[model samples]
Every structure is written in structure tokens, then in C-alpha cells.
Target: MIGKRVLSQEPVTLAEVKELTEAREKEGELTYEQTLTMDYCNKFAKLDKKKAEELIAEVEGLEKLSRRHAISLSDLLPSNADEIKLLFSKEHFVLSDEEISKLLDIVGKYKG
Candidate 1:
């Protein structure tokens, strides 16, 4: 682990995590933490990689949402306005009713 440095940091959805871990597994054995992460992603990832990417892209198009929010939305696909609000609870700004409806509609499209 010596001399390891993070070149950059970015948010990733569970589906992306699953994709990466699966690739690592195919190459060789995963470390213990990676195995645990793979298990978690397998159990909770709601969408596959392609769908997740699409969802992230669409979500990112909305105003006031960051890449982190897009990834979180794509990963959880919150069912209702309340759930969506819960996801954004820590943010300084609040989502309007219109925005919440928009988010729900987009999420519903992907859920199907």
C-alpha cells in the first residue's frame, strides 16, 4: 500500500461497483474487502451497468443535482417523493414539488 495516492475521486453507482468487482474476479481473486463489496453490490444493485449509466445521465440533466446525487438516485431509485427527499436530506437546498415529481417520473421509467 506504500506510495499509493488517489489520482481522483468520483461517485459510482452500485451497478458500476458490481461491474468492476466482477471484472476483478475474472482476472484473479479479489481481496477480502473487495469480496465483501462484491457481495453487497450483488445483493443491492437495482439496475445493471447499462441501465444505471442511462439513469445517471438522465438524472444529471436535471437542475440542482450533482453527479453524486445522480449516482445515488440511479443506485436507489427512490420510489416516492418522500424517499427522494430522504435521499437529499443532507443537502443544503431542498427540492421543489415539481422537481420531486420529475425525479419520481424518471425513476419510474427506469424501474420498469
Candidate 2:
């Protein structure tokens, strides 16, 4: 831990977290926190890695959406404009109705 340094940081979806933790567990042992995170992700992650990636990409194409927002949208897969609005409530920008509709359509495509 002392020698290791982070080269970069990026937000990731729950599906990515689930995949990474699973790979790490297969390689060796996971810490308690890691184990808990794996369990949580297993239970809560709505999309698989591929679907999450696609969702993130499509969501990111929308104007005003950041990577963090895209990842959050992928993780949550909000079904309606109201839910999407709540997700963006803390953000500085507001989404127009057309943008929200587009987001809903994109999410609907991936959501099962």
C-alpha cells in the first residue's frame, strides 16, 4: 500500500465493479469491504458489463452528461423522466424534456 500510487481515477458502473471484484476474488482473497461490495453489486447491479458499457456510452452522448452521470444512469437504469430528474437534482444544469425523453428511450432499450 505504501509504494502504490494511483495513476488515474475514473467513475465506474456497478456492473464494472462487480466484474473487477469477481476477477480479484478468483485471483486471491478479497478484504471484508471488497467482499461486501461484491455482494452488494451482485444483488443490486441491474445490467451486465456489456450492457452497462453500452448504456454509459449512449448516455454520455447526451449534452450536459458527465462520465459520472453516465455511470450512475447505467447503474440505476431509471425508467422515467421523473427518476432521471431526481438523479440530476444535485447537478448544476437542467435537462430539457426532449433530452429527458431521449434518455428514457436509451435506458428502455437496455433495461429488461
Candidate 3:
């Protein structure tokens, strides 16, 4: 099969964002989109690699959440319920405070 175009509306983890941006960088020059992706990746890179992975895992563990929402959480690694709610706004689902705390607990475990 030939190459397929990816829809950018979906949320992707910052790790994936970084990987894709770096690959594009090696291919010659970064496109405007690539530059934006790299910029956000750095901006949201508050957690180290392991902690980021934990955040992803935490977000994925929540029930009633779509994969896009989970990846968005991993990308932002937000520390509070408000930010999580904002990320889930387009997802059409609202997480409860207890659930938000659960995710925060998992992410907080790895925050050094």
C-alpha cells in the first residue's frame, strides 16, 4: 500500500510528537507544523521519561475515557483536575473529582 495521510485532529502523546518531529528534522528541514509540534513537546515536557510514561499509564486506566483523551493527558501531564477537564472538553466526557485524583496519584508517584 502507498502512504496514507494521518488526521491531525487526534491527540497524540508528547513522546510520539517528539519522535515524529525529530524524524522530520532529520529529513532536512522542519515544516511549520513540525516546528509547532516540537515547540509544544518541549513546553509540556515537565516530567521526565519515566514519569511521563506513568502519566500515560494513569490516564489510560480511567474508565469511560477515549484513547484520544488518554493521550492528551499523557501529552500535557496536567497536575490538576481543571486542566484535565479542559483536555477532555472536546472529548464530550467529564471525569469525576475522585477519578481525577486517581490519575493524579499515579502521575504523582513518579514526579521527582
Candidate 4:
């Protein structure tokens, strides 16, 4: 197929990627790039399967948050509002203290 441009947007998690990669590898279903990416994520993902899933669930449930930002929160797991604010610095948006506190509380739950 020929195309001028394609715009794609989707939300995904490292845990999901790992699971898919494992399945693909078992079935001999992936390309070289996919295999390499999966290997790297398995080695470097910040949270393990369980914690990552939990955080993704909690963060995505927040109305003010995007799935992408939720993934970042799962990855960084910031402890303070200041830290979270820094994560959001590139956005043309700001969160209230209460909102920041709520997000931090969710992040703290699985930190240990």
C-alpha cells in the first residue's frame, strides 16, 4: 500500500509488550527489531509485571491523566509533587496540589 502520511496513536505498557514478545518468540512470530526491543525492555523495564500492571490500572483510572502520562508515572514513580511537576513541565498544563497528591498516593502504594 502507498500512503502520504499516517498518524497513529495508541497507549501501551512495557508489561504488555513483554507478554506479547514472549508469546511471539514462542510462536516464532516476531521480526528482528521486535525481538531486540523485547529483549531490551525485559532487561531495563523499571517495574516488574505485577507492580507495573497495578500502577497502570490506577493511573489510567484518573480522569485528568492520559495513558501516556500514566505510563510515565509508572516508570518514574515520583515521590513528591515537585518531582511530578517536573515530569509535566513540557505540557501546557498544570495540576493542583490535591491532584498531584492523589497521583503520588497511587504511585506510593506499589513503591515498596
Candidate 5:
């Protein structure tokens, strides 16, 4: 817990090849050759098939994307938390009550 890693602001570019042809098809109108190529690519490629297929149909649906992460966990919490006593009892292998209380105290700082 003394240190943490961080990511750079700029995104790394993926290699553009025959693989990205499907992504281009998803973006706009696909030519006859492009359609045939996409079909072949989908048949042979051993990649994230579900995600790739979903991405093909998913337009620039920012309105839905923007609201997707709007819901907050704090909204579901009750004023009294005794009902949810052991939030992560099975997740961790703590040895003592003092250690568990310390863990909870540290976890309390993360609001969202």
C-alpha cells in the first residue's frame, strides 16, 4: 500500500491491418468485398467474438454510454448499516477483529 502505479493520459494506438477491417465495416457502409472480407474475418479470427460483433452494431451511442455510469453505490446504502455488517467477510482472509476493523476503516475512505 506504500506506492501505486499510474497510467499515461494518451491512449496507445493498436496496429491497423486486416483485423481493423471489421471495425471500419461497423463504422460505415461496407462494400461487397468488405462484407465478404468481414464474414471471412469473423469465421477465422479467434478473438473477442461477442465484443467484436457488438461493436459492429454499436453506433456512437454516447447518450446511453454517458448515463450508464451515472448510478452510484451510495444511493443503495441505508442510513443504518447494521444490516450489512460483514461487507466482505468471505473475500478477505483476515486473522483478527482488529485487522478487519482497520481494513473497514481504510475502505471507508473510498466514497465512490
Candidate 6:
């Protein structure tokens, strides 16, 4: 008989982010969010709550989903591959085609 195993990864929670920033500030060191965003364009990559909320709102606006755009409650219906392609193509986002395919598949499976 083979043994069973489970794996888990830590999520990037808001509390962890606060602790890291406080620790670095105490040492007069730059925070990870600061360092990462110093050379970046959008502030969403900061990983802070305020910025994260703003980004969420912006992305929701772009996706044209409902104000209550919970992933679980989203209208995941792809309608067709062409609509999926158009929805993804309109954004200057960085996601692989494979990822898009998977999203489309999830929506199709759920709503079709």
C-alpha cells in the first residue's frame, strides 16, 4: 500500500504583510512592497490592502462583471470561445493562453 500525503502553501494574507512592513521599518530597511513597486507601473503589485482593494475594483470594472463579482457567483458562461477570446484580448493583462483556456473551461462547465 502507498502512503498518502498532503501539501499546503501559505497564503499572502494582510496580517503577514503588516508584520513584514513593520519589521523592516524598525530596521530602517525598505519594505518588499516598496522595493517591488519602485520600478513598476501600477500600484496594484504593492500587495497592500488599500492598493489591493483599488486593483480589485479596477479589475472588476474592466472584466465588466457585476458589482457582486464573487468568483463563485460570477456568470462564468463563456457563451462561446469567441466571446472568451474577445474578453481576454481586450485587456493589456499578462496571462498565458493556457490559463485563459482553463478559465473558459471552468465557466463553460459550470454554465453550459
* Candidate number with greatest lDDT: 1
List lDDT for all candidates, in order. 0.93, 0.92, 0.70, 0.83, 0.36, 0.45
On a 0 to 1 TM-score scale, where does candidate 2 land against the true structure? 0.92
lDDT of 4 by residue, 26-104 (tens): 9977898998988887776667778887888888888778879998888777889999999998987888888899998
Please provide TM-scores, in order, for all candidate models, with all chains considered together.
Answer: 0.95, 0.92, 0.67, 0.72, 0.25, 0.29
**Model 6 TM-score, all chains together:** 0.29
Pick the TM-score winner.
Answer: 1
Per-residue C-alpha lDDT of model 1 across residues 5-60, encoded as one tens digit per residue? 99999888899899999999999999999999999998999999899888889988
- Record all residue pairs in model 5 with backbone atoms less than 3 Å apart, i.e. clashing: none
Where in model 6 is the C-alpha error above 4 Å? 1-73
TM-score of 5: 0.25
RMSD of 5: 17.4
Across 30-67, the per-residue lDDT of candidate 5 in tens digits comes to 88887787676555443243432333223113222221
Each candidate's number of clashing pairs is 0, 0, 0, 0, 0, 0
Task: Kindly give the stretch of ten consecutive residues in candidate 6 with the minimal lDDT sum.
Answer: 67-76
- Across 1-112, the per-residue lDDT of candidate 2 in tens digits comes to 7999999998888998999999999999999999999999999999999999888888888789988999988889898999999999998999999999999999999987
> Model 2, stretches more than 4 Å misplaced?
1-5
Error of 2 at 86 (Å): 0.7
Off by over 4 Å in 5: 1-18, 47-112
Ranked by TM-score, the better of candidates 3 and 4 is 4
TM-score of model 3 (CA atoms): 0.67
> Residue 90 of model 5: what lDDT?
46
